[model samples]
Structures are given as C-alpha cells and as structure tokens.
Target: MSTRHVLLGLLASGPSHGYDLKRRHDEQFPEARPLAYGQVYTTLQRLVRDGLAEVDGTGSDGGPERTAYRATEEGTRELSRWAGEITPPAPFVTNEIFAKVVVSILSGGDPAAYLRAQRAAHMGRMRELTAVKSAAGAGLATVLSADYALNHLDADLRWMTTTEDRLTTLTAEVDAA
Candidate 1:
C-alpha cells in the first residue's frame, strides 16, 4: 500500500497535523500494521518536498506548535489517477517458494518433502487467519483483510498441489536443462 496516497486521501478530508494524520490512518486501516511516528513525519516531509502537500499553518495545542498540512491540487489529481489504476498481480514465477523448490531438487534433496512442509505451514497460517476473522466481529476492515489473506493462501495451496502432482515431469525438465 502507498503511504503517500493514504496520507493524500486523509488530507483530502481537511488539513491536519502529523499526529492527527497518524490517528486517522490507524482508524481507517485497523488491520494494517501500525505506522511509526517517524514514518508519518518522513512521509509528510517527502510529500511537502514533492509539492503534493503544503504546510497550511501552525497551531499551538497546549504543547509544541504543530504544523497542519493540506493536499495540493496536483496531489488530488494524482490520488484520483492512482485510485482509477488497477494494480497488476505479483508474478509468482519469481516467488521464494518456487526458487526453494527448484534449488532443493537441484541439490538432490526431496522437493516433495519441502512442498509438504510448506503446505503444512500454509495450513497453520490459514487456521490462524480464520480465527482472527471470526474474532474480528463486524469490523469490515479486519474481516476484509483476513479474507484477502485467506484467499491468497488458498491459491498457494492449489499451486502446491499441482506442483506436487507434476514433480516428476518438473524434475525431468530440470535435469535436462
């Protein structure tokens, strides 16, 4: 996920201080890993440097003065373009699992055993995610995130099954190469 775009979207609501942006981000993306304060400030600085955001003003909120930021016209246009664009699926050909399987075979190890281990690991993770989803209650963000992960794990399990079925042919092809 693009932190830049996320901040831009938040700023679209209104000008906000760095601390406020961090709070809003956590509220909006409950399932996401928490953002560090330094990361928030760094992203804001980059946005300001790139002309995507500007420091609107500074305010004293009973402590140190906090600078408020607002999105620039260009930033809004960029955010719109990003929102409309479809992200391509990640290439599975270069995945670490595939590499590990091939390496195990080349080194005269049991690729099938490796695959079985991986499948077990995936299944364990799926169970954990399922529990999380169930406990998420009605939080759409948490449920959706868990669902997304579960779907990906399901696809990976399917791929592992297919690969195991074709291991003989794959080994032959690799040996030939």
Candidate 2:
C-alpha cells in the first residue's frame, strides 16, 4: 500500500495534524498495522518537500505545537489517479517456501515433513483469522481484509498439499539433474 497516497487521501477531507492523520488511518484501516508517529511525521515532511502538501500552520492543544498539513491540488489529483488505477493481482511466482522445499529435496532432506509443518502452520493462521473475522462485527473494511488474507492462505495450503503428493517425483527429477 502506498502510504504517500493514503496520507494525501486523508488530507483531502481537510487539513490535519500528523498525529490526527495517524489516528484516523488506524481507525479506518484497523486490519493494517498502525503507523508510527515517526513514520507519519517523516512522510508529512516529504509531502511538504515534494509540494504535494503544505504546512498550513502550527497549533497546540495544551501540548507541543503540531504542524497542520493540507494537500495541494496536485496531491489531490495524484490521489485520484491512484484511486482509479486497478491493482493487479500478485504473480504466482516461486516464493521462499517453494524454494526451501526444492532445496530440501536436492539436499536429500525431508520435503514431505516440511510441507506437513507448513500446512499445519497455515491451518493455525486460518483459524486465527477466522476468529478475527467473526469478531469484526459488520465493519466491511476489516471483514474484507480478513477475507482476502484467508483466501490467499487457503490457496497456499492447497498448493502445499499438491506439492507434498509430488515430492517423490520432484526428488527424482532433482537427483537426475
């Protein structure tokens, strides 16, 4: 996810302090890890430097003065363009787990055991995500996010099972090579 675009979108509502922006981001995107204060301030500084945002003013609510930021017209346009673009699905390429399994086979290790362990781990994570989804209430964002992750994990588990079945053939092929 583009933090730059997210910050701009938040600013579109109105000018906001960096702290408020972080708070709003956490509230809206609860599934995502919360942004650190340093990250928020640093990104804001970059936005100001790039002219995508301007430091409107500084004010304080009984604390240290906070710089308020407003998105520039260019920033709003950029955010609109980003919002309109369709994010492509991630390519089905070899990942670390696949690489590890192949290497294990080549090294005469137990690839089947690895797959079993991975499948168990995936199942555990799926259960955790299911619990989170069940407790998410009617929040569409949180529910959808959980669904996306659960679907991917389900696909991974299926792949692991298929790979486990073919481990013997894979080991033979690797030995021949």
Candidate 3:
C-alpha cells in the first residue's frame, strides 16, 4: 500500500504528527518495504499538495517542533475513496534467480554452479519462512504478523521448490537425450 493511503487511514483514526505516522508505518509495512524519512515526508508533502492533510498543530519530537497533520474534508473524501477502491495486495517482487540462471546458460556459464547458488538461496528462504511461521504460531513474531507473512512465505516456498524441481527434471531429460 502507498504511504499516502496508510497516512490517510491513520489520520482517519486521529490527528498525528509525522513521527507517529512513521512508527505506525514501521509496524504495518514489512521490513523489506522500509520507508525512509525522505519518502514519508515526500509522500506527506504530496498529500498536502493534493488537499488531503493540513497542519493542525506543532509539537516537540525529542527536540524540534514538528507539525501535526490532520485530514481535511477533501482529504478524508480522497482517503475514503482510496480505501474503498484500493484493497492492499501482496507486493510483487521479480524472481531474479530463474532469469539470471537463464542468462548464465545462454552465456555458456556453468548451469550447475548457478543452480547450486539458486538452490541455496531458495532453501535458505524456505528455512527462514518456516522459522517465521513457527515463531508466529508460538506468538513470538513482531506485531503478531506471522500469519500474513507465513501465508505468503508458504506460497513462495511452494512455487520456488516446484519450479526448481521442474527445471531439474527438464535439464536431466534433455541431458539424457
């Protein structure tokens, strides 16, 4: 989900300073999706420019005064429309392992070496994902987020393993021929 939508959703609940928004984003967004201060500020600026949030108050944040933001009527309307229209979907990350392996094969590099690296990577991912799910089941994951992460991880692991198996089978058959 866009930071715009998340900030607006937070504002819908209550007015908050930018730092608070940042904290909540850390909680909600995955670690891979780590947002920097610049991105948050930039997105907030866009929201302000689009007539979504307005400065309501200013306060100290451990040192300096930070402007608090609240949703404007137009902002609320936009946020609401966005919320209804935008059901957050899982992020789509391109699989470089297969692509790179293909490139290596075409370039006459050792397929086994590349595939070995890919195997390690995918296996490591599976183990990590399994650990995450276990931690979630044990109620140890951050923000009780194991379930959402687990579901996706399972999907990914399944796909990775299946793809690897199919590729290996194809390679073996072709080599035999």
lDDT of 2 by residue, 60-174 (tens): 9899998899999988988999999999877576698999998898888888998899899999999988888899364887788889999999999988988988877888889
For each candidate, what is the lDDT? 0.93, 0.91, 0.73
- RMSD in angstroms between candidate 1 and the native structure over all alpha carbons: 3.8
Q: Write the per-residue lDDT of candidate 1 for residues 1-177, one digit (tens) a residue.
A: 999999999999999999999999999998799889999999999999999999999999799999999999999998999989999877447888889999988988999999999999999999998898898364887889899999999999999999999999999998999
Sort the candidates on lDDT, descending order.
1, 2, 3
lDDT of 3 by residue, 39-149 (tens): 878888888898888888887858888988899999889877877785546476566765775655566566666666666775687677667666633655542565566
TM-score of 3: 0.53
TM-score per candidate: 0.75, 0.67, 0.53
Worst 10 residues of 3 by lDDT: 135-144
In model 3, state the lDDT of residue 144. 53
Model 3 CA lDDT for position 47: 86
Best candidate, lDDT-wise? 1
Model 2 lowest lDDT segment of ten: 136-145
